[model samples]
Target chain A: MARILVTDDSTFIRRRTCTILNRTGHEIIEATNGNHCLEIMQQDKPDLLFLDLVMPGLDGFGVLKTLQDAGNTIPVIVLTADIQDAVRDECMQLGAHTFLNKPPAEAAVLAALTDALAEGERKA
Target chain B: MTSAAHSSSTRQLNVLQKDAITELMNIGVGHAASTLHTLIGHKIELVVPEVSLITLDDYHQLQPYEADELLSTIWMGFRGGFEGNTSLIFPTDSANTLITALTGEMDDSPELDELRAGTLAEVGNILLNGVMGSIANMLNAALSYTVPEYMECSLLNIFRKNHTGNDTIMLARTTFAINELKVEGNILLFFKVASFEQLLISIDRELAI
Candidate 1:
């Protein structure tokens, strides 16, 4: 089972995401915001990161940029409520494996998890 | 007050009707909070603390806000399965605070300039669309919406200017806290008597299903 890090400022969204991921038998690590997410990344280095955009004090974009600058190749799947095409394009350009809208559906979450994990294995 | 206004003011919704509408509004507001959370990156807590059907006359009597207090309002007109105009209203100071919080602007000036007004409009657009979209989706109804407009005016003037003879108002009192900043606003939906009936019918149909 892969260890997944779920980061979001929202308790509801975070809990909902974790609940869905838990059913898949993946180990889940929770981070309240971006800084917390980065700290956890350095300490734990989870298998996959479920990132949220628009977090206070260092956001998803900042995390992606930091990781890129440091040459970290951790797979990230961005979950956001912002439906703007521009936002999606930016995340994709920043190396997000996929972009999923918030209030995430169970099927989509599982599908993304499977695909991202597979891609990571392929790269390894 | 006109006869229509008087009639609407006296009409009372039964407990079931009131509860159903209130619950639906809560769901809409919850969705709005989720969207707002993504926009500002702050954890947003939104509660439709109260939902009431009243008339412009009743609103005037209740005087929720100071009569002359300046308010930042974003309003839109909607039509289709049901027709009405809805607006999100916040006291000018609260609006400024909210804008500053979202934009991280140092200026706390009371005046809402063109740029700030535009920013507030975008925020309101996200919220109002969230509410309207969720409600419409739940009811499986089609709706056409007008371009949203932003206005800075007194609370009294807001209703006076938009007073469209239809007196029945569905007021959803929304309170949201973004991080440490708490802002309270009212979402007023003005519907004609017939349109209000149509909404209730739609709700009943949903309940039946």
Candidate 2:
């Protein structure tokens, strides 16, 4: 099972997402915001990251850019309430492996996790 | 600007502009409903039947809910190309009913205590994000939003706290039906004079394109 980091400012969303991932036997790590996410990444280095945009500070874009600049190839999946095409394009360009809307369905979440893990393995 | 001037400006929108705004709101509400259905595993129907722009002074005349009716409101402030506050407002009873239906909470309390308030806030966050995101996408406007806040208050009190006479409001009457439960609410967008003008410019740009 892969160890994953889920970052979002909303406690409810974090709990919901972690519950879903936990059910699948993946180890779950939580971060409250983007800055916290980066701090965790430096030490924990999870197998996958579920990032949320529109956070309070150093949002998803900032995290993605930081990882890209550091040459980190960890597979990143962006989950956000923002549905703008431009936002999706920016996420992908910043190296997000997958983009999913907020309140994502369980099946879609699982599918994205599987694909992201496989892609990560290939890169490794 | 004076209240009268603001009212005049709001009334200056041509029929086509008003229709376009209403249509955009309809699309946003539709998207929000789809997201809610996916989240709750329920059949959900959400529609924006009408949208009106009026100055805050006109608020009392156009008030949909009784002035003293208690409401569960989820409010989020947004800024970028334009600045405003948007809210999802439901009668307190309807809000409680919705939470109970979604969570299977057996609590019959009419008041949304802290725990339930969080749940409602998240739901509101998702719905408001859906509407705001869709509109922003269509307008090609980038916006930053404050985290959603949940409050229980009367409709008049809410207006008193958040608005001034110089502001303009775009009020959308929204209907929500989940399974057999039917709940009606209002999606209110409050903007200052400058922001309202900025919004009109953006809308005009969208129309021109």
| TM-score (all chains, Cα) for each model | 0.57, 0.86
For B14-100, candidate 1 gives per-residue lDDT tens digits of 667667777777887788887777656668766544656665555564246777877889887777777777778887767887777
Q: DockQ each candidate and list the results.
A: 0.03, 0.57
**Could you tally the backbone clashes for each prediction?**
1, 0
* Predicted candidate 2 versus true structure: per-residue lDDT over B27-132, tens digit per residue: 8888988888777677776554566566545556435677777789998888887788788888886788777766677676755365588778878888988888
Q: Model 2 misses residue B201 by how many Å?
A: 2.8
Candidate 2: list runs displaced more than 4 Å. Answer: B1-11, B45-48, B61-64, B107-115
**Per-residue accuracy of model 1 over A1-124 as CA lDDT, tens digit each:** 8899999865556766898999999899999788999999999989899998766688888898888788767789998655545567778988999899766778999999999999888877
lDDT of each: 0.73, 0.78
lDDT of 2 by residue, A1-124 (tens): 7889999887668877887899989899999889999999999989899999867788888999999999988999998887877778889999999999888778889999999999988988
TM-score, prediction 2: 0.86
Q: Which residue pairs show backbone clashes in model 2? A: none
